[model samples]
Target: MQNPTAATLYSQKQIPIGLKNTIDKTLSEYLKDEKLASYNIDNLKQIIEDSKINFNIKTIKWDEDGSEKSTSAEVASILGMILTFIIYMFIIMYGGMVMQGVMEEKTNRIIEVMISSVKPFDLMMGKIIGIGFVGLTQVFLWGILTTVLVSGSLFFFGGNTSPEDMVAAQMAAQGVNNVAAGSSDISIQVQEIINSINFGMIGTSFVLYFIGGYLLYAALFAAIGSALEQQEDAQQFMTPIMLLMAFSLYAGIYSMNNPDGPLAFWCSMIPFTSPIVMMVRLPFDIPVWELALSFALLFATALLIIWFSAKIYRVGILMYGKKPSIKEMIKWVKYK
Candidate 1:
C-alpha cells in the first residue's frame, strides 16, 4: 500500500479514506510507550479534550474597494520574510567575497602593479562591480534552474492533481459516487494568495534594495580589506558589522507578526538595517513616503561611504607592513 500500483488503484471500487492510517497508529503507539519527565495522564487528557472543543468564530475583513476579503496575508508575509533572508545572505556572502578578493590581490603584491596605472578608487570599484555581477548571475541562474525543475517535476507527476482527486477520479470512472469532498477549497485559496501579490511593486523594490544594500556593505568590506595587513585581523573590525546585520535579520523575523511596529519602522528607515528590514514590510504595503525615504537613505549612505572608503583604499593600498588603526583610517579620510 506504501507504493500502490496502477492496477491496485484501478481495481478499487472504494478508496480508503484515513480510517486506519498506519502512520497515525504508529505515532500514537510511540507516544503512549514513551517515558517522559513531564508525562501525566490527567494533564494529557485535559489537553486532548481542550483541543477538541471548538468555539463559534467569524472573521470579517474588507479590501480597499470595500469588498469582503478572503485572501490570506499570512502567505504574503512568509514570502516577504523569505526574500528578506535572501537579501541578508546575498549582501554578506558577496560582500565578504569582495573583502577576500582585495586581501588576496594586496597580499600577492598584485595591487602595486594594478595601482601603478589605475587609481585606487577605480580599482576598488572594479573589483566590487565585477564580484557583484558574478553574484547577480549566480542568483539569476538559480532562479531559472529552480523554476524549470519545479515545472518539469510538476508536469511529470501529473500537474496540480492531488492524490485524493486522482483516487476519486478513478472511482468515479467506474460508476461509483463514493468520492468524498476534494480539497478544491485549498487550491482556490492558494490561487487567491498568488493573485493577491503585487509583483510589479515587490519585484522592483527587491532589486533596488538588493543593489543598494550590496553596494553599501561591499564598500565597507573593501575599505576594511585594504586597511588590514593580515586576514586574521578582520575580526576586530567585522564584529560590529556582523552584529548589525544579525540584528537586522532578527528584526525582519520579529516584524512578521507586527510589520507596522515601531521597531520595524525605525529599522526600515535606518540605512544600516533598512535593506533587510524593508523587505519584510514590502508585502504588507507600507506607505509610499516610508518606502521612498528608506530607499533614499540607503543609496545616499552607500555613496557617502564609497567616497570615504575610497580615500582609505588609496592610502592603505600603498602602505605595507604596519597595521593601520581606527585613528589612522580616520586621518586617511582627510588626506589630500
Candidate 2:
C-alpha cells in the first residue's frame, strides 16, 4: 500500500481500464520470476521501486545575447487573432447597420427632405462617419469595461498565478500529481508567452485596422442600400461584398498560422483584405514599410470607393421600383 504507483492508483475513485490491465500484467510477470516467487508484497514493492525509471526534461530557449530567453510570441499571436476576429465582426455589423439605416430613410422618403438641404455625397459621408463613430464608441466602451472587470477579478482573486495554475493547484491538492505537474508546466509556458506581448502596439494597430476596414466597407454598403428600392432587393448587391468579407476572414485565419507566408503577405497588402489580414500579422515581426503601405492603400481605396459609391448613391437615391443591373449601374457612374 505504501508503493507510490499502487498508492497513486488506489487514490483514484476509478482506475482506467488500460492502467488496471497494465498493473495486473506487471504484477503477474514479477510473480512469474523464479527469484521473486517466494517474495511477499513488500519485497515486490521494493523491486518495483528499484526497477522504476524517472524521466526529467529541461527546455532551454536562447536569445541573441547567447543568454536564455523566454518569449510570449504565441500569446501575442492568440491575442492578435482574437482582436482580428473582433474587428471583422464589428465592421460587418456596423456596415450592415449603415446599409439598413440608408434603406429605411429612403423607404420613408426622409432622405428626400434631408437631401434638399444636404447634397447626396455629404449625406452619405455624414451617415458613414456618424455610424463609424458609434461603432468606435461601442468598441472603446467594451475595451474599458473588459479591462476593468479583468483587473478587478485579478485584484480580488489573486493575480500571481493564472487560471491554469489555479486549476493545477487544485488538482495537486486532490492527489492528481501527474496531471497537476503537466498543467503546471503549461501554465508557466502561458505566463511566459503573455509576458512577451506588446499590448500598446497591438491596441494602436487594432484601432487603425478597425476604422480603416469599416470605412472601406461602409461606403459600399451605403451604395448598395441606395441602389435598392426595398430592403429585400439589397441581397443581389450584398452577396459579392459579403463574399469578399468572408474571404478576408478566412485569410486572416490562415495568416494566424503562417504569418510570414506569401498568402499572408499579399493579402495583408491588398486593400480589401488588408484590414483583417494585416491585423493577424501585426503581433509578429512585420516590417514598418509594409504596414504603412497597407494603410496608405486602404485609405486610398476607401477614398476611391467613396467617390464611386457617391455617384451611384446620387443617381439611385431618387430612382425607386427599378433594381438597376450591373450595366445600368456602370452608366450611372458616367452621369455628370
Candidate 3:
C-alpha cells in the first residue's frame, strides 16, 4: 500500500512494486469467473496454502574474485550523491548570496560611491571571495566536529566492547535476530561504507571543485545582478542558469549506474557539469589522469568565465534602469 513519491521513481525499489502490480492485476482479471467467485474464504485460504507459490529474493553483489562485496553499489551511490548535494547547496546558497549582495549595493547606489575608489573587477572578486570564505569556514568546522564524533564513538565501541557483546552484535548484523540486532546490522553497514570511502581523495577534490564551481557560477550571477534594475528583471537570465543547474544534477544521477559510461565520461569532462558529475565518479575509483584533466578543466573554465563576467560587471554596474539584453551583455564582454 506504499505509494512512492515522485522522487522515488529514480529508486530501484520500484522493480518489486511493478512485479506485484502485474501479478495482482492478472489475478484479479482472471478471477472474475463465477465459479471462482463463489469460492468461500476458507476454500481460498486452503487453496493459497496448498499452492506453494512463494518467493524469497536475496541479492548479493559480487566482487572480481566472486566473493560478496563489503558494500553494495547502491550504498556507494548514496554516499556519492550526498557529497554532490552538499557541494550543490554550498554553490547555490553562497553564489546566490553573492548575487543578492551585488544587487543590494547597486539598488541603494552604494556601489557608485564604492566603485569610484575600488575597481569593478576588484569589487566583484572581493565580494565573491569574502562570502566564499564564510562557507569554507562553516564546512571546515562541520568536518572537524564530524571526525571527532565518529572517532570518539569508534574508540568506545572498539576498545570497551566485550567478546560476548561483539559476537552477539555480529549475529544481529547477519540476521534479524531481534529489533536491537537488526539495528546493529544497519550500523555495521554504515561503518563498512565509511571505512571503504577514500576520504583523502574525496575531501581534497571536493574543496577544489567546490571553490572552482562556486567561482564560475557566482561570476555570472553577479553580472546578472549588476545588469538588472529590479529582481524581476533577472528572471529571463535566471531561467537558463536554473535549467543548466538542473540538467547537470540529472546527468550526474543518471551516470551513477555506469560511472565509466560515455555519458559519465563526457559529463565529467565538461566544466559546467563536471563539479557535480565528477563527484559521482569519485567513489568508483576513476583513473588519476582523468581526475587531473577534469580538475584542470574546471579551474581553467572558471578563470576564463570570471574574466568575462568582470567585463560585464564593469559596464552593467554603471548603467541605470535599462534592462540589458543577453546580446547587450555579450557586447560588454567584448570591450577592450
Candidate 4:
C-alpha cells in the first residue's frame, strides 16, 4: 500500500498510532509472501507495539553495500573532468594578467619606488594574490554560468548521448560494428560500462582534483609572472610549464579512449598527469591503490613547486630591465 502523497503536518500529540499500525500490518502482510524480502512481520510488530518507528533511525539510514553503480560515478567523473578543464583553460588563458600587472608596475618605474617602501617579496606576493583573486572571481562567474547552461541542457534535452553511441563509435572505428550488430554480447558490454561509472567517486574526486590542479597551476603561473619583467619576457619560461600541462591533458584524453590500456594506467599513476587521467578513468574501473598513490605524489609535487616558485619569485621581482633566459632559470633552480 502506497502512503498518501498529500503532505500531512502532524503535531506531536494525538499521533496517528492506529493508522500507523494498520499501515505497518499491511506492509508486513505484503512482504511475508515474498521470500526474498528481508523484512518480516516481527519487525512490523515492534513498530506497532512501540507506536513509533523513530527509535530505528540508524536502521532506516542503513543501505545495501555497493548499491551505487558506475553510471552515476561516470557522470560525476565526466562532469568533474569538464569542470576541471574549464577552470584550467581559464587560468592559463588569463594568467597573463599577472605578468602584465608586474610589467606595468616596472614600466611605470613605480616598482622601484614601491621597493623603497616594501620588500620585493611583499610586493610580488601582493600583486600575485591580487591578480589571482581577479582571475578567481572571473572563474567563479564562469562556473555559475556553465552550471546553469548544463542544467538547462540536461533538463530540456534529456541529455540523450548514451553509452551505446560511444560503444558504436568504438566498434565502427575498430571495423567490428557489423559484427557487434544484433549481438547479445554487445548488450552485456554496454551494460557493464554503464554500471562501472560510479557517480559518487567521480563527483568527489572531480571536486578534489579540480581544486588541487587549479591551485597547483596557479602557483606556477604566479611564479612565471614574477620571473618575467614583461609579458613578452614570460614566453621562454612559461613554455615548459605550458608543455607539461598540455602533455598531461593529452595523455589523460588518450587514456580515456583506451581506459584499460597500458598508457592510461601509467599516465593515471603519474602525479602530474593523474588529474586528467583519473578523471577519464572515473568512467571506468580504477584501483584504490592507484588513486591514493597518485594523490600523494601530486600533493608532494605541489608543495615542492610552491617552495621553488616562492624562491624564484623572491629573486625575479627585483631584477628588472633585463630578459631572463633558461640558463639563468637553471641558476635560480639551483640556488640553495
Candidate 5:
C-alpha cells in the first residue's frame, strides 16, 4: 500500500513469499465469492490508478487522442497545391540566379580569371551553395513572417472554436439528424476535408521532397551557368532544364488526379519528379517501404548527377570560343 513496500516488492528477483501469499489469498477469496470478484477488480484498478497517478493525468485529453479516426485526403490535396506553387516560385527565383551568375561572370570577365584560380567544379559549387544559402535564408524569413501573420489572424478572428461546433460537425457527417438546423453544408465539407488531411505525412514529405528537388535542380543550374561564358550562350542550355522542371511539375499535377495510380507511384518514386509527385500523394498515403526506396533512388541520382555535372563543369568553365553543342557536352561527361 505504501511506496517503499511497493518498490521493494517490484525490485525482488522473484515475487517475495509474503506478497505471493497475499496475492494467492486475494485471488482465492475473490474466486469463492462472485460479489468479491467485482470488488477485487475495482480495488485492483484503484490501486494501480493510485500508484500511477501524476500531473500528466490532469493534462491528458483521452477524448481527443482516443477519439474517432479521420481521413487526410483533403489536407493533402491542399498541401500539394501549395507545394506546387512554391516549387514554381523557387524555380523562378533560383533559376534567375543561374542567369544572373552567368551575366555577372560575363560582364566582369571574372569567369576567365576564376577558372585559372580554382577548379571549375569548386567555383560552381561555392557560388551555387552561397546563393542557395541566400535563397534558403529568404525562405526561412518568409516562413517566420507567414507564421506570425497566420497566428495574428487567428488571434484577431478568435480561433477559439467551441467544442459543440466540432461535435455538431462530426455528428452531421455521420448523419446524426436534427442536431443543427443552421449548420452550413460548406462548413461541414470543409471540416471533413480538413479532417481527412494527414498533417504529419504532408509536412515530412514536403520538407524532404522540396529540399532534394531543390538541390538537384540547383546543381544542374550551377553546372549550366559554369558552361556558358556569355548570357546569350546560357539561353540555349536553359531551355532544356526549364522544360524538365516544367514537365516534372506538370507531371506532378497530373499525378495528383490519381494519387494511388500506377503513374503516380512511378512518378513519385522517381527522384527528379518525386518531390512534387510524392507531396501530391501524401494525402492518399505512401507506404513506408516505397518511400524508403524512393529516397534511396533520389540520393543515388543526385550523387550521380552532381558527379557528372562536376565533370562537365571542369571543362565547361574554361570553354569560351563558342557554345558547346550537345555532342561536346556528352564528351565532357565521358572525359577523364
Candidate 6:
C-alpha cells in the first residue's frame, strides 16, 4: 500500500475515502490465506468505516445584534488595531515636533523677540494650534491619498474575484482548509464584514481624539520647553510625561485583547490615556453613554491642562540659567 504524504493528504480530494479503499484492498490480499479468511468481514468493514474520517471545524461568534462569523470579527479587530497604533504614533511624533520647535526658538533667543510683541498666552496658544493644524493636515492628506491608492489598486487588480473567493484562494494556497465548508462560509461573509464597519464614526472619533490628545500633551510639552534653558534640562521633566504616554500605549494594546474589560473601561475614561484607549475600543460595540462621557471628560481635562500649562509657561519662559525643581515649579504656578 502507498503511504500518504503531506502533499497528498492536504491537496487530494476524498483523502480518507481513498486511503480506506487502499487499506482494505491491501488487507484483503494479505489475508487471503484460509486461516485469515475465516475472520469476520463485518468487523473489518466497521473498523475501516470508523477510521475513514476528516475534521473541519468552524467557530461562530454571536454579538448583541446577532450571530457573527469569526472572519468578520477578525478583520474588524485587525483594522481597529492598525488604526489605533497609527493614531498613537502620530500623536507622539507631532507632539515631539511641537516640543522641539519650542526648544529651538528658546535656544536661539528668538522667543524673546517674539514675546516682545505677543502675550505669553497668545504666543503659546498660537504655537500649539499652529503645529497641531499642521499635523492634522498631514493626517487628512494621508487618509485621502491612502484611500485613493487602495481603491485604484482594487479596481485595477482585484478583478471580479469576490472577497470570499480571495480568501478561499489564499487558504487553498496554504493547503489548510480547517474552517468549515472549505472556506466557503468565510468567503460568503467577507462583504458583510466590510459593510459592518462604521467608517464615519471611526473617522469622526479619530479626528476628535487626535486633536484632543495632542493638545493635552502638547501644552505640557510646551511648558517643559519653556522651563528649560538648555535641551538637557527638558529631560528631567519629560520622563514622567513619556511614561504616562507609554502607559496609554500598553493600555491600548490590552484593550485590543479585551475591549470590554474593566481595565479598558477605566483607561478609556481617564483623560491621560483615553485618547489611545478609547480609539481602540471604538471599533467594538461600546455604549453611547460611555463614549459620550469619555469625550466630555477628555475635553474638560484638556482645557484644564492648557490653563495650568499657560501659568507655568508664563513664568518658566522668562527664568534662565538655572533648572527649576518641582518645588520651584509649584511656586511659579502660585505667582500672581
Weakest lDDT window of 10 consecutive positions for candidate 3: 1-10
Better of 1 and 5 by lDDT: 1
Q: What is the C-alpha RMSD, rounded to one decimal, of candidate 1?
A: 12.3
Deviation in Å, model 5, residue 16 alpha carbon: 95
Which is superior by lDDT, 3 or 4? 3
Top candidate when judged by lDDT against the true structure: 3
Q: What's the CA error at residue 52 for candidate 1, in Å?
A: 2.5
lDDT of 3 by residue, 158-277 (tens): 535543576577785665456666655555555555555677788788888888899999998999988987888888998998888888888888889899999999999899899888
Model 2 pairs whose backbones collide: 72-193
Residue-level lDDT tens digits of model 4 in 271-295: 6666666777765556788788877
lDDT of 2 by residue, 1-336 (tens): 223233235554777799889988887566455445455465775787789999855444554588643465565577768888898899999999999999899889999999999999999999999999999998889778867875664454545876566665767665646765665665565554444455567677778888888988999999888888687787888888889989998998888888999999999989999998888888775788998898899989989999999999999888888889878987899999
Write model 6 residue lDDT over 1-336, tens digit each, in one string: 233222222545555787877866766556543333367465665575689889955435566789564435565577777777888888878888778887788778899999899999999999999989998998799779866864664454443567667666766765555554444544455434544566678778888989889989999988888888777777888899889888988888888888999999999999999998887788786899998999999989999999888999888887778889978887887788
Query: What local lDDT score does residue 159 receive in model 4, on the 0 to 100 scale?
Result: 38
Better of 3 and 6 by TM-score: 3
Give candidate 3 misplaced runs (Cα > 4 Å).
Answer: 1-69, 156-192
Candidate 3 TM-score versus the reference: 0.74
Clash-forming residue pairs, model 3: none
Local error of candidate 1 at residue 330 (angstroms): 0.7
lDDT of 1 by residue, 133-165 (tens): 987887667667755874665555445775456
Model 2 CA lDDT for position 215? 88
